[model samples]
Target: MLEMYRSYLAACNERAWDTIAEFLHPSVLVNGIPRTREQYVDDIRKTIAVFPDYAWQLRHVVQQPPWLAVHLHATGTRHQDFLGAPGDLSPVETDEFAMYRIADGRIAELWGTADNARLRLSTHNETR
Candidate 1:
């Protein structure tokens, strides 16, 4: 499961849109909301559009059977305003944590959050 999770992240970093369905179930649940695999792909696409150079670097991971917990360092240069930060193409970085439930070797459910407040603070400070 750990290796598979890593591969999933790899595909995301590669912006492999066509391969996303291979890592996510057709009926995926994200943060308690039901979303189709295409919706998930759209969400990723929107984020990448805002942060053209976005990447998620794995900081930690733990796997317990069908559950996987991940900590990631997400970084990018903003192409548009985000988290109250000006869209001056400044660098932004944040920590993200997520727990995933895998079904049939693909992610079926995910609960995740990112440190947006910290990123906002850092960006605000930089503008000072």
Candidate 2:
């Protein structure tokens, strides 16, 4: 399961949407967002476009039967527009975590949250 998670992050950083598809269940739910495989691919593309060098640093991993939770620190620079926000050279870092539910050896669902305050501080120079 850790290997799968590592591969998933690699695929995400490399913007390999096709490769990412292999690790996800056909109907994967990310956070509260239910997405089809194509939708997932689209979201990944948009993310990579926004943060060209996005990378994740694994902090810890915990496993329970049928579930895996990962604590990660993600860092990147904005290089392209995203969700109407223009790119900036300022580096952004956020502590994020995700809990994945595995079914049949594939990721069936993910619930994730990130340090939005830190991200906004680093990127937009705003505090929340």
Clashes of each: 0, 0
Compared with the true structure, what per-residue lDDT tens digits does model 1 show for residues 9-111?
9989999998877899998999999999999999999889878888999999888878999999998878887768767777778889999999889999999
Question: Estimated TM-score per prediction?
Answer: 0.91, 0.84
**Positional deviation of 13 in candidate 1, in angstroms?**
0.7
* Superposed model 1: Cα runs more than 4 Å off: 121-128
Which residues of candidate 2, in runs, are more than 4 Å off? 81-86, 123-128
The number of the candidate with the highest lDDT is: 1
lDDT of 2 by residue, 1-128 (tens): 88888888888777788898888889989887888878888876776676778788889999995899999998888776544545666678888888999888788898988875564435557554
